[model samples]
Target chain A: MSTTNNHEPILSFKDVTFAYEPHVPATLKDVSFELPKDSFTVIVGPSGSGKSTILRLVTGLDKAQKGSVQNTARTRMIFQGGALLPWETTLNNVKVGFTGRKMSEAQKTHDAMAALTELGIDTLGDSYPRHLSGGQRQRVGIARALVSSPELLLLDEPFSALDIETSKRLSDEVLRIHSEQHITMLMVSHSVEDAVMLADRILVFKDGHIAEEIPVSLPRPRTITDPEVQAIIKHVQGTIPSSG
Target chain B: MKVTHTELQAKPRMTTHYWSHRGRRAHRTNLLHRIGSGLVLPIALVLVTGFLATGVALVPSRISAEAGTLLAALGASFLRLFIAYVFSLVIGVALGLLAERGRRLESALLPIFDVLESMPVLAFFPVVIILFLKANLLEGAAVFIIFFSMVWNIAFSVVGGVRQTPEDVKAVGVVFGMTWKERLFKILLPSVFPAILTGSILAVADGWNIVIVAEALRAYAPQSDKAHDLFGIGSILVHASSTGDSTTLLAAMGILVVAIALVNIALWQPLLAYAERFKFE
Candidate 1:
């Protein structure tokens, strides 16, 4: 695995509290965490446990009602739904990621193809979103996010929308990306198996707060069948509070 | 020995996966060719419109005096519709943006727009004429009426577009760090486009239907016939009907039908097809 060995914090949420409105109950309360550069962190919890909300906060789509959210790294998100612009071809949709950049149109197209090539999806460039399968669309979403060469990547339930086989395949590819590029990732997911497979750190959330923050130091190429991987998964599951 | 994440990355991105997506796009392109005989409609439209534009240029010089009068009336009516549609588009986009500014404003404005829009084309005309004639604005009476006909639906469509914008698309704007200007132009406007297209198509159809009644403003202000100068398809048809001039009436009817057809085929249909890309399927 490529090692950056940079221990600087890229993102921090300090005593942050968030709510959709005054009447609505808080989605998060007194949440605090730090994401160091070049690590893969996964937030895992139940449906309303504020996992996805944390990702949104990182992306600045929702401001914390109290405290502060500070980040030094440029970030991009791979949304749960892919969020591919329906009007554009896969290549064109990926190109929008470079909207503010000074790249020429030809360069945008070239870089977009290169990103797709990295995701193993260059052949799907000319196709529109409607023409693509769920797996293909998610790969396109990843390509769009990676094209910016962002220091941070946010993924909100990236595999919740995919099937079993596709999810496993995508999860492995994401693991490869982390091992190869060392881009800091903050992902929210429902899959404990995915957390064990990919994350360098696993954060268990309950009632809008972090219940446990566990560092994962398993060797590269860890599998669920491995005892250490299963032990981490079991530990994370137990750390999560009951749904009631 | 289990294949791990690193080994998986070495797996070839299978060619079979490309067949459905890449293949489908190629199939659709081929299908478009098959349906329209190699996409000749555009080439044909350019050739036809070019020839007509040239013929139109030589109207007074080459055409008969009677035909020229018909063409002139057609041009006048078409010009009014064009101007009115332009006004409608500007007002529609402006009002749409305004309506989205707040929930209270939308709640206040939407019902008012609905009530006015649902009223018949004639309901607003008499009031508008009274005001225009009182202000000595008889020349603009028809154009104003057409604007009213076209603006409401387009405005509502804009409102709907903003309200129904997908959450993920909004997140896209936030994540990409798009500025307010970029978000409005690139993301927000494009998200609202299919609705705008739908509204505009209906509004133009409504505009054409009402232009006839609108141009009969001369009936209300007979004393100002020379001042009003309401020369158009509506006026010609009105005159031909009252005089029982069968030949002129048939010619006017024929040209009106042809004009609406050409516009639908050339402009709206192509745009509607292009809008399929924004479906978010």
Candidate 2:
């Protein structure tokens, strides 16, 4: 809805397929997508439906054996569990992605603090990961990913473990980050409301293939009550089974 | 009467705080109770042992039989062990990191450590002597034996610690952009602190057992024709077996047990306490 000029794809996954084990048939098969620049895309699917596989392949965490993926090399992933290193303070954890790199310690600390401060967690710089609340930890997760100034940010159900309110708050934070940083975001979220509220496009995966790509033409700072967003949500709900 | 949404949320939040406070209080009480209970056992032992030693002749028969000499031997052995422990810890940590990072190398080298652990230290006494003789590393020979006895446990424990690292934690490291060294130092080492301490405690025990044998075995001087008497539990056992000294042998056995107990309390207990401060999340 933003622009019909779809000539350039920031990331292209051409017929990618992957499996967890050799004996098993592919968890994802012939999955293909072209993500445009600075787009907030959400992939929703049932469990074992290759939503995570897509994220992993895009982030280069796991390679696809069957097909090729072309994307920016500097892709940072935010794991579902907010896997902040337990030993690190919030700032140090953010800086861990830059340790021993060309950046000076002072610069690393400053950059890490800037990221945390942007997420409204600057006071938690010295606090260890164990000390933070669930929402706080997710904020740290976002900070860690953003601190690297990555070209592409991959989010793997980063709010699934949180309460509904916390999840919404985190989603708002993520939206703020996307708008501010302008990083291409590909998130895997199961919540229909989450997909509605944040994503520019919602991708529905079924049986290892992207079954549907629904575009939201809703206005910025989108809320759940927007009629267009609700209709799209209803459409996505109808397309996917209720159990998912 | 409808409760506000904030009021509804406040109830669970307040309850959580209340429960966590209660849990903290219970934990503190439990710790105090355990400490109190542990003191009783040590006090009762002191009473019983004092009663047993009453009116027994405290004459110094051999150097080890004398309390002063036994104390000195314990101190020297402890010093040797401390040196060995420091070296093993450094080497084990380095090797463990390498082994964890290098899977192929780990598979190759880990079996050798397993075999070394399986081989009893006593079985290698002759080998240690022969090797020390050929190498001519005089001052550090006893320490070498101590180090050898302790190294494998630390290495294996560290290896296990690395392997047992939760996938969630590793993912966190990757997401955060931790370098190999930062991951090893901050993520890996702190995560494995308990295992390292557990292995260290076992290693200290093993090294203590081997020290007496090492000193006694090395006390033999062939050319001088007068063996410098090695004074330890092993020496006591040797003398008792040779001359049919039952009471003294029992006394020596008691001494060895006490020595082991003291070392466990003084050395390993503190380390264990320190390690336990950092619980697994």
Candidate 3:
């Protein structure tokens, strides 16, 4: 809502249709969307509703079957499971995403340490991922994604596996990052509350299409009890199509 | 009376400290195991090295009915097994990785490997003789046979490991733009290490069993016995049994037992313990 009248989209998926297998029905049928700069958007849907498929396609992990996916912004994705390498320590894990690029070890180590430090995990840099807690591992995941200073951050149910307290803390951190760094954030979340808390706009998916795009024009630091936010949440809940 | 949420959480937090204490006990146990294994391996190594030295000192002809020749024969047999083991390891890793190329290939390879692995070593004799004997690799026929027995364990386990990699991990590879080299060295191999270690233990066991015929099959190759039969522990055992050389047979068999036991204690067990950290939770 704070975005200016910027006509250009940082990333766009025009008429995108995708399927995991050739024999299966299309998961996303002619879906289209353009994300504005420095905005937080959440895709809300039931399972197999193409919510995660959209996230994957954005990261080029799963290409669209028939459509144009034009991305001008440098992008990174944080996973649901944190996905840290079991062998590598926290610092080395931060360095994993920067594979094959031309950079000195010293520079990379410095950058990785700085990113870990930013995430409040610099002291645990030498510890292997197996030794870290779930929350700590996800923090490492965020550090890894942010190491390259990507313009757009894609989150694939990043807090689904976490407990409520950890989830809320991470949500706050994400909001801070979005506001302070001015990075475009697109998240796929099943929780209506999560969608309400962080998203500037919620794209409610039905079957294989985005059924409704609900906008939240509330000010920063919103709460569930806010009258306007409650109205938006109620609207979003009603807009979601019932699954069989 | 209602318990506070923090009060409830405190129970598990306290147990975490208890678990840490248990972890310290485990570390102490692990250190003891290390010391025990350390002592066993060097003694075993020194014995093996002594045999190796004896074999080096003596010519090929001197390997005979004497108990003195048993240590040297054990060394030669152990060497053949080791060489075969190394070959199997490389081939198995390659086959496992190759199977991961596509789903179709993977499906096809599983059944083929199953059939190949299930077939008895003796059953494959004609094919082995044809391939290895004609190739003139050595009593080297044993190496090939041992390789076959061992490679399957590794290949199958590696494929399984690759299959079990978490979806999120694979997604990370793509989102981060991981090169093939990085994926293999960092993610693939490290993740698959526990599997590889497990496979290797079985492979070495298989290698031990096959090394017998592998060294003794020289006569079947239509070469003269003295010229072709390699002076390995397997051959020594076979030769002693046939000729009723009881002293040499017992000594050679003893060496074999000690070698296997020592390797399990010193190498595989420790490696398995180390690889526990590599597995994806």
Top-DockQ structure, candidate number: 3
Give a tens-digit lDDT track for model 3, residues A116-224: 8778878778877766778888899998998887888999898999999889888988998999988899999988888998999999998889899988878777887
- Candidates in descending DockQ order: 3, 2, 1
| Candidate that beats the other on lDDT, 1 or 2, i.e. the better one | 1
lDDT of candidate 3 over B24-109, digit per residue (tens): 11233444455455456655654555456344322234335454667777788788778877887888887898898777898888
Candidate 2 wrong stretches, greater than 4 Å? A1-8, A20-24, A100-107, A225-227, A238-244, B1-68, B94-116, B136-145, B175-178, B218-279
Chain A TM-score compared with the true chain A, each model in order = 0.95, 0.93, 0.94
DockQ of predictions, in order shown: 0.29, 0.30, 0.37
Lowest lDDT 10-residue stretch of candidate 3 chain A: A1-10
Error of 2 at B190 (Å): 2.7
Question: Model 1 over residues A1-244: C-alpha lDDT tens digits?
Answer: 2223377688989999998768888999899999888889999998898988887888887789899998888889998879888877789889878968888999999999988887777777777777677888898899899888888889888898999998888888888887787789999888888887888899999989988899999987787799889888888888877776
